[model samples]
Target chain A: MSHKIKGGCQCGAVRYSTDAEPMVTFNCHCTHCQQASGAPFTTAVAVQRENMTISGDVIEHTQTSDLGTLVHRFSCAKCGAYVYGISDGFGATAVNAVTLDDASWVEPQMEVYVSSAQPWTHMDPALPKFDKLPPMEES
Target chain B: MSKKIEGGCLCGAVRYESDAEPLFAVNCHCRHCQMTSGSTHIPGIGLPAAAFSHTGDVTWYKIQNDRGGQSMRAFCPTCGTPIMGQIEGEEILFLHVITLDDPGGFAPQMDIFESSAQPWDRFDDTLPRFAKMPPMGE
Candidate 1:
């Protein structure tokens, strides 16, 4: 079903909305995800970059991924809430799932970078797991 | 085993170190956590503020919790990596566990604010669970 999802930063400085159904939803356990989120992993939903619109001042931090691709993380400057990310190797922008105004609906369909998952972190056995980001075509 | 742990933000704009072992560690699933870390939840270690030392440019954002308590979250201004959080009047600072140089060493003893956890997130049954922040001593 097609619907609009809304979210914003903690301080209400940044707001975003997307009407496109997510192409994929997944959890990432790569060390970069860990550092970027200050958590064991991060949950995100990927959508067509053209389908999303964001307002307010946000800053982007670019880092080279282990796969040799550049990933740009965007966050609210006022509250420092991570909003979304863009990867040079991927066509879609990944919005941090937790930033959704109503995140209860998010259900990760897969787990990626499982090889780097922390030993103590738990994962749903029911979801498909990958040692790394699956091929772009598969996603 | 006790060991000194050190870490910094992605842009290297902020750095911190702690010599004392974590007194308590937990995975917090509160909405506040989700907003701050932009993740399902945040893994944090409660450490004595006295034992922690930080350097570089850090920004603090104050937010009032649902309970009307004031919480201050600190992050690196340049990279936006959340470094730590502190509740007003509390002596311990909750350090973002994942920010540690050796984050793999972290072992969460419990899960807190499970009531706020997202449907997609799962927690280990092995850890103690609290629907909300337990009493200070509990």
Candidate 2:
């Protein structure tokens, strides 16, 4: 169960744990995610904001996502490891998927912003893809 | 011929420019990279130290690798971007290629630290793969 999800920043300056399973998982290929994550895509694990217990200080950077929604990204104040994010665009607090202590349980539900994905990025063909965001029923 | 490479963090709070050609490019699946990038691996380019410049704030987080060498992760504080990394005593700086002004420019030639790779990670299956860090001269 994803209930055991726990992780911290690379420097251990920020640590977090959540006892609840993620409600949604997405692989975002938007340029904003690409630049922010320094990877072709970001696997975002969405969970209830109240379910997480975080220790240590974190600084938030607010930015308008490519979809024109406000997404607040957070990084460890000292180490700069991206930890998690919050946005009105979605129902839950999104954790940077790999930031989990163990991400082997992750299986992205869908791929978004495929139009902005890096040419060399290899993705699983079995997963659904979208050129941009798909119609969503935000909780 | 040398070409200039330029890029920055997502929020435009940090910028960097390099005039030297990269020595190599690869995708690293080390656990540290996974933790930092929040992705499967790091698509980075190894560049020589000279003729590189950057502006704005960057936070560096240092960690000891499985090999026991210290490598520091450099990220933008304002935007939370994984900017680059450096191994202590090493002359090269590995910059995350996805942060480039033109993210389309990255051409990764290999994969490293595969022993720690996740099962869900998918690759093109064309590049050479190393179980761990590759011998530099090879």
Candidate 3:
């Protein structure tokens, strides 16, 4: 069994625990991620829904991802720091690894959608990357 | 009247103060901003760097900006709040408007990078508009 990952909102009002290890960790360079993260990319860790436990009142904001998938953004109602995102079309959800209690275990696997990546954004040269969404079967 | 705005990282390890009002406000419709804010538009309040004061260590995530220059994003490592953004050549710091005492006071002056905007999106047409960032010098 994978070690449990725990984290919560900035205000500590909402807490979540996951028993399943993240299947994929990616840094997304899409413009939406830039605008939302206010940075060049958003680093996320994906895990199966059944392996996670979430608590506290969360406010959800929905958006259509570049892939035409519905991504539900979950934030703490009290503190407002965006916490997690779950896609409706898939059985997996991506958590903000930065918020995890023990995020060291989840290493970033790749950087996605580099075509829209800001020119100055830099990454470690060794990591694998793709210009657009990676095929689901390959990811 | 100069006022001091005080905010800190989630763990209170980093603190900052901004005395000047933003030169402008903006709402980014790009996917990056969308992922960060978890919203339709990520609004920012831009203030000249000279008017801002800060204390404590802020870890920055450097990114390439649209203008082919480097941009620095300072955030609280403890709390993870995106505190501000700074461009290599510009004197301004794009502070997260949401950190303001009266967040509503900072509103967008224009909409930029709209060429990548979504199809179902609709915004007020009365505001100043630009298909992408205004021709550099404008």
Candidate 4:
């Protein structure tokens, strides 16, 4: 079943909508994600890059991933709220789950980069945890 | 026990150091925190404002809390990394835990603002939970 989702930054300066369901959902515990979210980890919902429509002003910053791929992070210029990320390694764009208007449906299927996770940070025991990004399956 | 710690933003444009140990640590589930950090909750280490030294430029945004209190959030404009938050009329400056160079050292003793927490976000059941910020001494 497919449904539309909507969200925006804190200042309401940046908004986004997608009619596609997330292909996969996960939580990242990498150091980069920690820095990006200023939290233990960040939850992400991956959707087809072309399926999402984003509007308003956003600023982008690029960083090299642990796998040596370039990851571009986008955030609201006005409120500094992280909106999403695009990685060269992953063809899909990952939206920050916290930015979603309705987050009750978000259920991460896996935890990546668990080796870098802080000791005090907790994760769902039921979700598969990988020390690093698991080998991607062919779509 | 006391320790010195250092940290900076992703771009390294904003940096901070503190010699004083954290006065307290908490996992905040306030909506303001979720919005600013772009996460379910923010783990923070409260430090005395006077004991912290910061360098480089930061962009500050002011937000009103549920109680109509003023809150100031600061982040690095270059990297969009949240640095710290300050409650109006409060002397403590809460540093984002993940911003610390050694974030593992942080151990949250409590969870606050659980009432505003997203249903999907899980918390450690062992930690004390408060519907709101506990009284100053409690």
Instruction: Tell me the TM-score of each prediction against the true structure.
Output: 0.95, 0.93, 0.53, 0.95
Instruction: Please report how far candidate 3 places residue B108 from its true position, in Å.
Output: 22
TM-score of 1: 0.95
Chain A TM-scores, per candidate, are: 0.91, 0.87, 0.87, 0.92
Model 4 lDDT tens row, B93-128: 989989987787778999999999876687899999
Arrange candidates by DockQ, descending. 1, 4, 2, 3
Looking at candidate 4, what is the lDDT of residue B6? Answer: 92
The ten-residue window of minimal lDDT in model 4 chain A covers: A1-10
What DockQ does each listed candidate score?
0.79, 0.75, 0.07, 0.76
TM-score of chain B of each: 0.95, 0.93, 0.77, 0.94
lDDT by residue (tens digit), candidate 1, A54-126 = 8998868899888677888887888888888887767678888888887767888999999999888899989
Q: Please identify model 4 stretches exceeding 4 Å from their true place.
A: A137-139
B1-138: candidate 1 lDDT, tens digit per residue: 267879888888888998898888899999878888888899899899999998998888899988888988888878888888999888899999888877777778899999998888898988888999877853
Cα lDDT for residue B82, model 4?
86
lDDT of 3 by residue, A49-139 (tens): 7777899876565667776778776755554446777877676787766566655565667888899765535454667889987777512
Compared with the true structure, the alpha-carbon lDDT of candidate 3 equals: 0.63
Docking class of 1: medium
- The residue pairs that clash in candidate 1, if any, are none
